[model samples]
Target: MTLPEAPRGRPRDTRAHQAILTATAELVAEAGYAATSIGAVAARAGTGKDTIYRRWSGKAELVYEAVFTETESGPVPDTGSLTGDLTALVEALVQEFSAPAAAAALPGLLADFAANPGLRSRIRGHFLAPARTRLAEVFERAVRRGEADSAVPVDLVLDTLAGAVFFHVGLVGEPAGPRLAGQLAGLVGRGIEAR
Candidate 1:
Protein backbone atom coordinates (compact mmCIF):
# COMPACT_ATOMS: atom_id res chain seq x y z
CA MET A 1 0.00 0.00 0.00
CA THR A 2 1.15 3.50 -0.83
CA LEU A 3 1.26 5.57 2.32
CA PRO A 4 1.08 9.34 2.02
CA GLU A 5 4.31 11.25 2.36
CA ALA A 6 4.50 14.28 4.61
CA PRO A 7 3.16 17.26 2.69
CA ARG A 8 5.79 19.32 0.94
CA GLY A 9 5.92 22.62 2.82
CA ARG A 10 8.12 24.30 5.35
CA PRO A 11 10.76 21.93 6.62
CA ARG A 12 9.87 20.13 9.84
CA ASP A 13 11.25 21.54 13.06
CA THR A 14 14.27 19.52 14.09
CA ARG A 15 13.56 19.95 17.78
CA ALA A 16 9.97 18.83 17.40
CA HIS A 17 10.99 15.84 15.31
CA GLN A 18 13.58 14.75 17.83
CA ALA A 19 11.12 15.29 20.66
CA ILE A 20 8.55 13.11 18.97
CA LEU A 21 11.05 10.29 18.36
CA THR A 22 12.39 10.51 21.91
CA ALA A 23 8.89 10.54 23.37
CA THR A 24 7.91 7.53 21.30
CA ALA A 25 10.94 5.57 22.49
CA GLU A 26 10.35 6.56 26.11
CA LEU A 27 6.68 5.60 26.02
CA VAL A 28 7.35 2.31 24.27
CA ALA A 29 9.97 1.49 26.87
CA GLU A 30 7.96 2.65 29.88
CA ALA A 31 4.58 1.20 28.92
CA GLY A 32 5.34 -1.37 26.22
CA TYR A 33 4.30 -0.95 22.59
CA ALA A 34 0.81 -2.40 22.99
CA ALA A 35 -0.09 0.26 25.51
CA THR A 36 1.58 3.21 23.82
CA SER A 37 -0.68 5.33 21.65
CA ILE A 38 -0.33 8.27 19.29
CA GLY A 39 -2.13 10.42 21.84
CA ALA A 40 0.26 9.34 24.56
CA VAL A 41 3.24 9.99 22.32
CA ALA A 42 1.90 13.47 21.54
CA ALA A 43 1.36 14.13 25.23
CA ARG A 44 4.85 13.05 26.11
CA ALA A 45 6.36 14.92 23.21
CA GLY A 46 4.52 18.15 24.11
CA THR A 47 3.06 18.31 20.62
CA GLY A 48 -0.32 17.65 19.04
CA LYS A 49 -1.22 14.52 17.12
CA ASP A 50 -1.37 16.53 13.91
CA THR A 51 2.29 17.36 14.19
CA ILE A 52 3.16 13.66 14.32
CA TYR A 53 0.64 12.73 11.63
CA ARG A 54 2.24 15.28 9.38
CA ARG A 55 5.50 13.40 9.65
CA TRP A 56 4.47 9.76 9.99
CA SER A 57 1.54 7.66 8.87
CA GLY A 58 0.88 5.98 12.23
CA LYS A 59 2.33 4.58 15.42
CA ALA A 60 4.04 1.65 13.66
CA GLU A 61 6.05 3.93 11.37
CA LEU A 62 6.82 6.33 14.17
CA VAL A 63 7.86 3.64 16.58
CA TYR A 64 9.95 1.87 13.97
CA GLU A 65 11.79 5.08 13.11
CA ALA A 66 12.21 6.10 16.74
CA VAL A 67 13.55 2.75 17.84
CA PHE A 68 15.10 1.08 14.79
CA THR A 69 16.50 3.90 12.68
CA GLU A 70 19.36 4.71 15.05
CA THR A 71 20.81 1.25 14.61
CA GLU A 72 21.80 2.11 11.07
CA SER A 73 24.29 4.73 12.19
CA GLY A 74 27.66 3.66 10.73
CA PRO A 75 28.56 1.91 7.53
CA VAL A 76 29.06 -1.83 7.67
CA PRO A 77 32.72 -2.67 8.20
CA ASP A 78 34.93 -4.41 5.63
CA THR A 79 37.78 -6.36 7.19
CA GLY A 80 39.34 -7.97 4.07
CA SER A 81 37.95 -11.39 4.89
CA LEU A 82 34.54 -13.05 5.18
CA THR A 83 34.89 -14.08 8.82
CA GLY A 84 36.25 -10.72 9.81
CA ASP A 85 33.50 -8.83 8.00
CA LEU A 86 30.84 -11.09 9.39
CA THR A 87 32.23 -10.69 12.88
CA ALA A 88 32.02 -6.92 12.63
CA LEU A 89 28.55 -7.03 11.14
CA VAL A 90 27.28 -9.57 13.65
CA GLU A 91 28.78 -7.66 16.57
CA ALA A 92 27.00 -4.52 15.48
CA LEU A 93 23.73 -6.41 15.17
CA VAL A 94 24.16 -7.86 18.64
CA GLN A 95 24.83 -4.45 20.11
CA GLU A 96 21.96 -2.80 18.28
CA PHE A 97 19.40 -5.48 19.06
CA SER A 98 20.50 -5.61 22.66
CA ALA A 99 20.08 -1.90 23.26
CA PRO A 100 17.31 -0.89 25.64
CA ALA A 101 15.07 0.68 23.00
CA ALA A 102 15.51 -2.15 20.54
CA ALA A 103 15.14 -4.79 23.21
CA ALA A 104 11.89 -3.25 24.34
CA ALA A 105 10.49 -2.30 20.97
CA LEU A 106 11.36 -5.32 18.81
CA PRO A 107 8.71 -7.64 20.13
CA GLY A 108 5.98 -5.12 19.53
CA LEU A 109 7.41 -4.04 16.20
CA LEU A 110 7.52 -7.65 15.09
CA ALA A 111 3.90 -8.09 16.12
CA ASP A 112 2.98 -5.06 14.06
CA PHE A 113 4.90 -6.49 11.13
CA ALA A 114 2.90 -9.70 11.34
CA ALA A 115 -0.43 -7.89 11.34
CA ASN A 116 0.40 -5.19 8.82
CA PRO A 117 1.78 -6.27 5.45
CA GLY A 118 2.29 -2.67 4.40
CA LEU A 119 4.27 -2.03 7.54
CA ARG A 120 6.40 -5.06 6.83
CA SER A 121 7.34 -3.71 3.42
CA ARG A 122 7.86 -0.20 4.73
CA ILE A 123 10.15 -1.45 7.46
CA ARG A 124 12.12 -3.53 5.00
CA GLY A 125 12.51 -0.43 2.88
CA HIS A 126 13.48 1.92 5.68
CA PHE A 127 15.42 -0.38 7.97
CA LEU A 128 16.49 -3.61 6.31
CA ALA A 129 17.24 -2.45 2.77
CA PRO A 130 20.25 -0.34 3.64
CA ALA A 131 21.86 -3.00 5.74
CA ARG A 132 21.19 -5.62 3.12
CA THR A 133 22.67 -3.43 0.43
CA ARG A 134 25.88 -3.01 2.37
CA LEU A 135 25.99 -6.68 3.22
CA ALA A 136 25.57 -7.58 -0.42
CA GLU A 137 28.85 -5.80 -1.04
CA VAL A 138 30.50 -7.93 1.61
CA PHE A 139 29.17 -11.08 0.00
CA GLU A 140 30.36 -9.93 -3.39
CA ARG A 141 33.85 -9.40 -2.03
CA ALA A 142 33.85 -12.86 -0.47
CA VAL A 143 32.81 -14.44 -3.74
CA ARG A 144 35.41 -12.51 -5.73
CA ARG A 145 38.10 -13.57 -3.27
CA GLY A 146 36.97 -17.19 -3.58
CA GLU A 147 36.06 -17.32 0.11
CA ALA A 148 32.42 -18.14 -0.53
CA ASP A 149 30.36 -19.98 -3.12
CA SER A 150 29.45 -17.85 -6.12
CA ALA A 151 25.82 -18.85 -5.78
CA VAL A 152 25.54 -18.50 -2.03
CA PRO A 153 22.18 -17.25 -0.89
CA VAL A 154 22.81 -13.87 0.70
CA ASP A 155 19.34 -13.67 2.21
CA LEU A 156 19.72 -16.95 4.07
CA VAL A 157 23.05 -15.86 5.44
CA LEU A 158 21.50 -12.59 6.55
CA ASP A 159 18.52 -14.34 8.09
CA THR A 160 20.73 -16.78 9.94
CA LEU A 161 22.86 -14.04 11.44
CA ALA A 162 20.01 -11.68 12.21
CA GLY A 163 17.47 -14.28 13.26
CA ALA A 164 19.81 -15.95 15.71
CA VAL A 165 20.58 -12.65 17.40
CA PHE A 166 16.93 -11.62 17.43
CA PHE A 167 15.91 -14.85 19.07
CA HIS A 168 18.75 -14.70 21.57
CA VAL A 169 18.41 -11.09 22.59
CA GLY A 170 14.86 -10.08 21.68
CA LEU A 171 13.02 -13.21 22.72
CA VAL A 172 15.23 -15.20 25.08
CA GLY A 173 16.30 -12.03 26.91
CA GLU A 174 19.88 -13.21 26.96
CA PRO A 175 22.76 -10.78 26.68
CA ALA A 176 24.82 -11.39 23.53
CA GLY A 177 28.31 -10.06 23.47
CA PRO A 178 31.27 -9.88 21.12
CA ARG A 179 32.27 -13.42 21.87
CA LEU A 180 28.93 -14.65 20.67
CA ALA A 181 29.26 -12.41 17.67
CA GLY A 182 32.65 -13.86 16.80
CA GLN A 183 31.45 -17.40 17.22
CA LEU A 184 28.35 -16.82 15.10
CA ALA A 185 30.41 -15.18 12.43
CA GLY A 186 32.85 -18.07 12.38
CA LEU A 187 30.05 -20.62 12.16
CA VAL A 188 28.21 -18.89 9.38
CA GLY A 189 31.38 -17.89 7.63
CA ARG A 190 32.54 -21.49 7.46
CA GLY A 191 29.11 -22.62 6.31
CA ILE A 192 29.08 -20.16 3.45
CA GLU A 193 32.75 -20.40 2.64
CA ALA A 194 33.90 -22.09 -0.56
CA ARG A 195 32.45 -25.53 -0.05
Candidate 2:
Protein backbone atom coordinates (compact mmCIF):
# COMPACT_ATOMS: atom_id res chain seq x y z
CA MET A 1 0.00 0.00 0.00
CA THR A 2 1.14 3.54 -0.71
CA LEU A 3 2.26 5.69 2.17
CA PRO A 4 -0.23 8.31 3.32
CA GLU A 5 0.09 11.59 1.50
CA ALA A 6 1.74 14.49 3.26
CA PRO A 7 -0.42 17.44 4.20
CA ARG A 8 -0.39 20.25 1.66
CA GLY A 9 -0.36 24.06 1.91
CA ARG A 10 -0.09 24.35 5.71
CA PRO A 11 -3.83 24.29 6.22
CA ARG A 12 -5.26 25.37 9.59
CA ASP A 13 -6.65 21.98 10.51
CA THR A 14 -3.41 20.24 9.67
CA ARG A 15 -1.50 22.81 11.66
CA ALA A 16 -3.78 22.26 14.65
CA HIS A 17 -3.32 18.50 14.37
CA GLN A 18 0.43 18.81 14.37
CA ALA A 19 0.32 21.30 17.19
CA ILE A 20 -1.69 18.98 19.40
CA LEU A 21 0.70 16.10 18.80
CA THR A 22 3.70 18.31 19.43
CA ALA A 23 2.19 19.77 22.55
CA THR A 24 1.37 16.34 23.92
CA ALA A 25 4.92 15.13 23.28
CA GLU A 26 6.48 18.24 24.83
CA LEU A 27 4.26 18.06 27.89
CA VAL A 28 5.07 14.42 28.42
CA ALA A 29 8.73 15.31 28.10
CA GLU A 30 8.61 18.19 30.57
CA ALA A 31 6.23 16.59 33.01
CA GLY A 32 5.88 12.85 33.41
CA TYR A 33 3.25 11.06 31.34
CA ALA A 34 0.89 10.80 34.29
CA ALA A 35 0.98 14.57 34.62
CA THR A 36 0.07 15.38 31.04
CA SER A 37 -3.61 15.97 30.24
CA ILE A 38 -5.77 16.83 27.29
CA GLY A 39 -6.53 20.26 28.74
CA ALA A 40 -2.88 21.03 29.08
CA VAL A 41 -2.13 19.74 25.60
CA ALA A 42 -4.91 21.87 24.14
CA ALA A 43 -3.69 24.92 25.98
CA ARG A 44 -0.15 24.31 24.79
CA ALA A 45 -1.35 23.78 21.26
CA GLY A 46 -3.28 27.04 21.31
CA THR A 47 -6.48 25.11 20.68
CA GLY A 48 -9.42 23.94 22.76
CA LYS A 49 -10.01 20.73 24.70
CA ASP A 50 -12.92 20.03 22.38
CA THR A 51 -10.53 20.07 19.46
CA ILE A 52 -8.35 17.40 21.03
CA TYR A 53 -11.40 15.42 22.05
CA ARG A 54 -12.67 15.52 18.50
CA ARG A 55 -9.41 13.98 17.28
CA TRP A 56 -8.73 11.50 20.11
CA SER A 57 -10.87 9.70 22.64
CA GLY A 58 -8.45 10.24 25.52
CA LYS A 59 -4.93 10.99 26.68
CA ALA A 60 -3.56 7.51 26.05
CA GLU A 61 -4.53 7.49 22.40
CA LEU A 62 -3.27 11.02 21.85
CA VAL A 63 0.01 10.37 23.61
CA TYR A 64 0.56 7.07 21.84
CA GLU A 65 0.08 8.66 18.47
CA ALA A 66 2.09 11.73 19.44
CA VAL A 67 5.04 9.67 20.59
CA PHE A 68 4.94 6.87 18.01
CA THR A 69 3.33 7.93 14.74
CA GLU A 70 6.54 9.12 13.15
CA THR A 71 8.43 5.97 14.07
CA GLU A 72 5.96 3.84 12.14
CA SER A 73 5.76 5.95 8.98
CA GLY A 74 9.20 5.75 7.42
CA PRO A 75 10.04 3.94 4.19
CA VAL A 76 11.10 0.35 4.75
CA PRO A 77 14.81 -0.22 4.17
CA ASP A 78 16.11 -2.46 1.41
CA THR A 79 19.89 -2.30 1.58
CA GLY A 80 20.59 -5.44 -0.48
CA SER A 81 21.81 -7.71 2.35
CA LEU A 82 20.15 -8.86 5.56
CA THR A 83 22.80 -7.23 7.68
CA GLY A 84 22.45 -3.93 5.88
CA ASP A 85 18.67 -3.96 6.14
CA LEU A 86 18.81 -4.96 9.79
CA THR A 87 21.33 -2.23 10.47
CA ALA A 88 19.09 0.37 8.88
CA LEU A 89 15.98 -0.76 10.75
CA VAL A 90 17.82 -1.04 14.07
CA GLU A 91 19.35 2.37 13.59
CA ALA A 92 15.91 3.85 13.05
CA LEU A 93 14.56 2.11 16.13
CA VAL A 94 17.50 3.23 18.24
CA GLN A 95 17.12 6.77 17.05
CA GLU A 96 13.38 6.73 17.71
CA PHE A 97 13.31 4.99 21.10
CA SER A 98 16.35 6.93 22.27
CA ALA A 99 14.70 10.30 21.68
CA PRO A 100 14.10 12.29 24.83
CA ALA A 101 10.37 12.63 24.26
CA ALA A 102 9.85 8.94 23.49
CA ALA A 103 12.01 7.82 26.40
CA ALA A 104 10.08 10.02 28.78
CA ALA A 105 6.64 9.19 27.38
CA LEU A 106 6.86 5.39 26.91
CA PRO A 107 6.95 4.25 30.53
CA GLY A 108 3.75 6.08 31.29
CA LEU A 109 2.16 4.95 28.05
CA LEU A 110 2.99 1.31 28.82
CA ALA A 111 1.53 1.73 32.28
CA ASP A 112 -1.70 2.92 30.73
CA PHE A 113 -1.60 0.02 28.30
CA ALA A 114 -1.45 -2.43 31.19
CA ALA A 115 -4.58 -0.92 32.69
CA ASN A 116 -6.54 -0.69 29.44
CA PRO A 117 -6.77 -3.71 27.21
CA GLY A 118 -8.87 -1.93 24.59
CA LEU A 119 -6.35 0.87 24.37
CA ARG A 120 -3.54 -1.63 24.10
CA SER A 121 -5.29 -3.52 21.34
CA ARG A 122 -6.02 -0.33 19.46
CA ILE A 123 -2.44 0.81 19.83
CA ARG A 124 -1.15 -2.51 18.55
CA GLY A 125 -3.48 -2.37 15.58
CA HIS A 126 -2.58 1.16 14.55
CA PHE A 127 1.15 1.52 15.18
CA LEU A 128 2.67 -1.90 15.82
CA ALA A 129 0.81 -3.60 12.98
CA PRO A 130 2.16 -1.26 10.34
CA ALA A 131 5.71 -1.55 11.60
CA ARG A 132 5.47 -5.30 11.81
CA THR A 133 4.01 -5.52 8.35
CA ARG A 134 6.95 -3.53 6.98
CA LEU A 135 9.43 -5.66 8.88
CA ALA A 136 7.77 -8.78 7.55
CA GLU A 137 8.31 -7.51 4.05
CA VAL A 138 11.98 -7.02 4.80
CA PHE A 139 12.24 -10.55 6.19
CA GLU A 140 10.37 -11.98 3.20
CA ARG A 141 12.89 -10.36 0.89
CA ALA A 142 15.77 -11.71 2.98
CA VAL A 143 14.32 -15.21 2.86
CA ARG A 144 13.86 -15.00 -0.90
CA ARG A 145 17.46 -13.93 -1.31
CA GLY A 146 18.66 -16.74 0.99
CA GLU A 147 20.05 -14.23 3.46
CA ALA A 148 17.71 -15.30 6.23
CA ASP A 149 16.12 -18.57 7.27
CA SER A 150 12.44 -18.84 6.58
CA ALA A 151 12.00 -20.23 10.06
CA VAL A 152 13.33 -17.09 11.71
CA PRO A 153 10.73 -15.71 14.07
CA VAL A 154 9.80 -12.09 13.29
CA ASP A 155 8.05 -11.24 16.54
CA LEU A 156 10.94 -12.55 18.62
CA VAL A 157 13.39 -10.41 16.70
CA LEU A 158 11.18 -7.34 17.19
CA ASP A 159 10.77 -8.03 20.90
CA THR A 160 14.48 -8.55 21.38
CA LEU A 161 15.48 -5.32 19.68
CA ALA A 162 12.79 -3.20 21.31
CA GLY A 163 13.29 -4.82 24.71
CA ALA A 164 17.03 -4.29 24.63
CA VAL A 165 16.63 -0.61 23.83
CA PHE A 166 14.09 -0.05 26.60
CA PHE A 167 16.18 -1.99 29.11
CA HIS A 168 19.39 -0.28 28.12
CA VAL A 169 17.95 3.20 28.17
CA GLY A 170 15.24 3.07 30.84
CA LEU A 171 16.85 0.77 33.39
CA VAL A 172 20.56 1.26 32.73
CA GLY A 173 20.22 5.05 32.24
CA GLU A 174 22.69 5.05 29.40
CA PRO A 175 22.20 6.62 26.00
CA ALA A 176 21.52 4.10 23.20
CA GLY A 177 23.75 5.43 20.50
CA PRO A 178 24.03 4.76 16.79
CA ARG A 179 26.84 2.29 17.46
CA LEU A 180 24.42 0.12 19.40
CA ALA A 181 22.29 -0.27 16.27
CA GLY A 182 25.11 -1.75 14.17
CA GLN A 183 26.18 -4.05 16.99
CA LEU A 184 22.61 -5.16 17.57
CA ALA A 185 22.05 -5.77 13.87
CA GLY A 186 25.23 -7.85 13.72
CA LEU A 187 24.14 -10.06 16.62
CA VAL A 188 20.57 -10.46 15.33
CA GLY A 189 21.90 -11.00 11.82
CA ARG A 190 23.98 -13.94 13.01
CA GLY A 191 20.92 -15.68 14.34
CA ILE A 192 18.74 -15.23 11.25
CA GLU A 193 21.30 -15.67 8.46
CA ALA A 194 20.67 -18.77 6.36
CA ARG A 195 22.92 -21.75 6.93
Candidate 3:
Protein backbone atom coordinates (compact mmCIF):
# COMPACT_ATOMS: atom_id res chain seq x y z
CA MET A 1 0.00 0.00 0.00
CA THR A 2 1.20 3.52 -0.82
CA LEU A 3 1.51 6.06 1.97
CA PRO A 4 -0.34 9.36 1.67
CA GLU A 5 1.64 12.41 0.63
CA ALA A 6 2.36 15.11 3.24
CA PRO A 7 0.20 18.22 3.21
CA ARG A 8 1.59 21.28 1.42
CA GLY A 9 1.80 24.70 3.05
CA ARG A 10 4.37 27.34 3.89
CA PRO A 11 6.50 25.98 6.70
CA ARG A 12 6.85 28.19 9.79
CA ASP A 13 10.15 30.06 10.08
CA THR A 14 11.59 29.01 13.41
CA ARG A 15 14.47 31.38 12.76
CA ALA A 16 12.16 34.39 12.84
CA HIS A 17 10.57 33.09 16.02
CA GLN A 18 14.02 32.76 17.56
CA ALA A 19 14.97 36.28 16.46
CA ILE A 20 11.90 37.67 18.15
CA LEU A 21 12.63 35.72 21.30
CA THR A 22 16.24 36.91 21.31
CA ALA A 23 15.09 40.48 20.85
CA THR A 24 12.58 40.13 23.66
CA ALA A 25 15.27 38.77 25.95
CA GLU A 26 17.61 41.62 25.15
CA LEU A 27 14.91 44.25 25.57
CA VAL A 28 13.71 42.75 28.84
CA ALA A 29 17.26 42.72 30.11
CA GLU A 30 17.73 46.38 29.21
CA ALA A 31 14.27 47.44 30.28
CA GLY A 32 11.96 45.58 32.61
CA TYR A 33 9.02 43.76 31.04
CA ALA A 34 6.69 46.57 32.09
CA ALA A 35 8.72 48.96 29.96
CA THR A 36 9.74 46.59 27.17
CA SER A 37 6.97 47.36 24.70
CA ILE A 38 5.97 45.11 21.81
CA GLY A 39 7.00 47.90 19.46
CA ALA A 40 10.51 47.75 20.83
CA VAL A 41 10.63 44.00 20.36
CA ALA A 42 9.43 44.40 16.80
CA ALA A 43 12.02 47.07 16.14
CA ARG A 44 14.84 44.99 17.60
CA ALA A 45 13.68 41.88 15.78
CA GLY A 46 13.34 43.72 12.46
CA THR A 47 9.79 42.45 12.26
CA GLY A 48 6.58 44.41 12.26
CA LYS A 49 4.48 44.76 15.42
CA ASP A 50 1.69 43.16 13.41
CA THR A 51 3.81 40.04 12.97
CA ILE A 52 4.38 39.81 16.71
CA TYR A 53 0.71 40.37 17.43
CA ARG A 54 -0.14 37.76 14.82
CA ARG A 55 1.86 35.21 16.78
CA TRP A 56 0.87 36.43 20.27
CA SER A 57 -2.02 38.41 21.68
CA GLY A 58 -0.17 41.08 23.70
CA LYS A 59 2.79 41.95 25.86
CA ALA A 60 2.17 39.32 28.54
CA GLU A 61 1.68 36.54 26.00
CA LEU A 62 4.70 37.67 24.03
CA VAL A 63 6.87 37.82 27.14
CA TYR A 64 5.67 34.42 28.24
CA GLU A 65 6.45 32.92 24.83
CA ALA A 66 9.82 34.63 24.69
CA VAL A 67 10.89 33.35 28.10
CA PHE A 68 9.60 29.85 27.45
CA THR A 69 10.97 29.67 23.93
CA GLU A 70 14.43 29.67 25.47
CA THR A 71 13.71 26.46 27.33
CA GLU A 72 14.23 22.98 25.87
CA SER A 73 12.33 19.84 26.66
CA GLY A 74 13.14 16.27 27.69
CA PRO A 75 15.47 13.78 26.07
CA VAL A 76 17.14 14.22 29.47
CA PRO A 77 19.89 11.61 29.51
CA ASP A 78 19.37 8.28 31.22
CA THR A 79 23.09 7.39 31.40
CA GLY A 80 22.08 3.95 32.73
CA SER A 81 22.48 5.12 36.34
CA LEU A 82 20.59 7.41 38.71
CA THR A 83 23.65 9.26 40.01
CA GLY A 84 24.91 10.07 36.55
CA ASP A 85 21.48 11.18 35.40
CA LEU A 86 20.98 13.33 38.47
CA THR A 87 24.41 14.90 38.02
CA ALA A 88 23.71 15.68 34.38
CA LEU A 89 20.33 17.10 35.30
CA VAL A 90 21.86 19.43 37.88
CA GLU A 91 24.52 20.49 35.39
CA ALA A 92 21.88 21.36 32.79
CA LEU A 93 19.85 23.34 35.33
CA VAL A 94 22.94 25.26 36.47
CA GLN A 95 23.93 26.01 32.89
CA GLU A 96 20.51 27.46 32.16
CA PHE A 97 20.63 29.63 35.27
CA SER A 98 24.11 30.86 34.40
CA ALA A 99 23.33 31.91 30.83
CA PRO A 100 23.73 35.70 30.53
CA ALA A 101 20.36 36.37 28.94
CA ALA A 102 18.55 34.08 31.36
CA ALA A 103 20.39 35.58 34.32
CA ALA A 104 19.64 39.13 33.23
CA ALA A 105 15.95 38.44 32.58
CA LEU A 106 15.23 36.63 35.85
CA PRO A 107 15.02 39.62 38.18
CA GLY A 108 12.48 41.35 35.99
CA LEU A 109 10.53 38.13 35.66
CA LEU A 110 10.34 37.82 39.42
CA ALA A 111 9.17 41.40 39.72
CA ASP A 112 6.49 40.91 37.08
CA PHE A 113 5.31 37.75 38.78
CA ALA A 114 5.02 39.61 42.05
CA ALA A 115 2.94 42.37 40.48
CA ASN A 116 0.49 40.10 38.69
CA PRO A 117 -0.70 36.78 40.07
CA GLY A 118 -2.52 35.90 36.85
CA LEU A 119 0.53 36.54 34.72
CA ARG A 120 2.60 34.52 37.17
CA SER A 121 0.27 31.57 36.71
CA ARG A 122 0.55 31.87 32.96
CA ILE A 123 4.35 31.81 33.20
CA ARG A 124 4.32 28.87 35.58
CA GLY A 125 2.08 26.92 33.25
CA HIS A 126 3.99 27.68 30.08
CA PHE A 127 7.63 27.76 31.23
CA LEU A 128 8.06 26.27 34.67
CA ALA A 129 5.69 23.34 34.21
CA PRO A 130 7.52 21.87 31.23
CA ALA A 131 10.91 21.97 32.94
CA ARG A 132 9.41 20.59 36.10
CA THR A 133 7.78 17.80 34.12
CA ARG A 134 11.09 16.74 32.61
CA LEU A 135 12.78 16.72 36.03
CA ALA A 136 9.87 14.81 37.54
CA GLU A 137 10.28 12.08 34.93
CA VAL A 138 13.87 11.62 36.08
CA PHE A 139 12.79 11.32 39.70
CA GLU A 140 9.99 8.91 38.81
CA ARG A 141 12.38 6.69 36.90
CA ALA A 142 14.72 6.59 39.90
CA VAL A 143 11.87 5.65 42.17
CA ARG A 144 10.86 2.81 39.84
CA ARG A 145 14.42 1.59 39.68
CA GLY A 146 14.55 1.38 43.46
CA GLU A 147 17.06 4.23 43.56
CA ALA A 148 14.80 6.77 45.24
CA ASP A 149 12.02 6.86 47.81
CA SER A 150 8.65 6.36 46.21
CA ALA A 151 7.04 8.26 49.05
CA VAL A 152 8.88 11.49 48.21
CA PRO A 153 6.73 13.86 46.25
CA VAL A 154 8.08 14.68 42.77
CA ASP A 155 7.12 18.33 43.22
CA LEU A 156 9.15 18.47 46.43
CA VAL A 157 12.16 16.96 44.74
CA LEU A 158 11.89 19.36 41.78
CA ASP A 159 11.51 22.34 44.13
CA THR A 160 14.46 21.29 46.25
CA LEU A 161 16.79 20.91 43.31
CA ALA A 162 15.68 24.08 41.52
CA GLY A 163 15.42 26.11 44.70
CA ALA A 164 18.99 25.27 45.68
CA VAL A 165 20.37 26.34 42.30
CA PHE A 166 18.30 29.55 42.12
CA PHE A 167 19.23 30.50 45.70
CA HIS A 168 22.92 30.21 44.92
CA VAL A 169 22.68 32.18 41.69
CA GLY A 170 20.11 34.85 42.67
CA LEU A 171 21.20 35.40 46.29
CA VAL A 172 24.96 34.92 46.21
CA GLY A 173 25.37 36.32 42.70
CA GLU A 174 27.60 33.35 41.95
CA PRO A 175 27.71 31.55 38.62
CA ALA A 176 25.80 28.32 39.01
CA GLY A 177 28.56 26.12 37.77
CA PRO A 178 29.66 22.52 38.06
CA ARG A 179 30.58 23.13 41.67
CA LEU A 180 27.00 24.10 42.52
CA ALA A 181 25.71 21.24 40.40
CA GLY A 182 27.94 18.77 42.19
CA GLN A 183 26.79 20.09 45.54
CA LEU A 184 23.13 19.86 44.57
CA ALA A 185 23.58 16.40 43.07
CA GLY A 186 25.30 15.17 46.19
CA LEU A 187 22.51 16.39 48.43
CA VAL A 188 19.75 15.10 46.17
CA GLY A 189 21.44 11.79 45.48
CA ARG A 190 21.76 11.06 49.17
CA GLY A 191 18.09 11.80 49.66
CA ILE A 192 17.06 9.62 46.75
CA GLU A 193 19.41 6.67 47.17
CA ALA A 194 17.87 3.62 48.68
CA ARG A 195 18.87 3.17 52.33
Best by TM-score: 2
| Candidate numbers sorted by lDDT from highest down | 1, 2, 3
In the order shown, the candidates' Cα RMSDs to the true structure are 5.6, 4.3, 4.2
Model 1 earns a TM-score of 0.80
Residue by residue across 26-80, what tens digits does model 1's lDDT show? 9888888888899999998898999999999898889877886665667767899
State every prediction's TM-score relative to the real structure. Answer: 0.80, 0.84, 0.80
lDDT of 2 by residue, 1-195 (tens): 223464554477778999999999899989979899898999999999998999898998898788866666768898998888888887777776777878788878888888988887775466577667877888999999988899978888777877786688766868876588889888998888899
What does candidate 3's lDDT look like per residue over 41-64, in tens digits? 989998889989888867766775
Selected candidate, larger TM-score, 1 vs 2: 2
Which regions of candidate 3 are displaced past 4 Å?
Answer: 1-10, 29-35, 54-71
Task: Look at candidate 1 and tell me the lDDT of residue 105.
Answer: 82
Prediction 2 TM-score vs. true: 0.84
The C-alpha lDDT values of all candidates are: 0.83, 0.82, 0.72
By summed lDDT, which 10 consecutive residues of candidate 1 come out lowest? 1-10
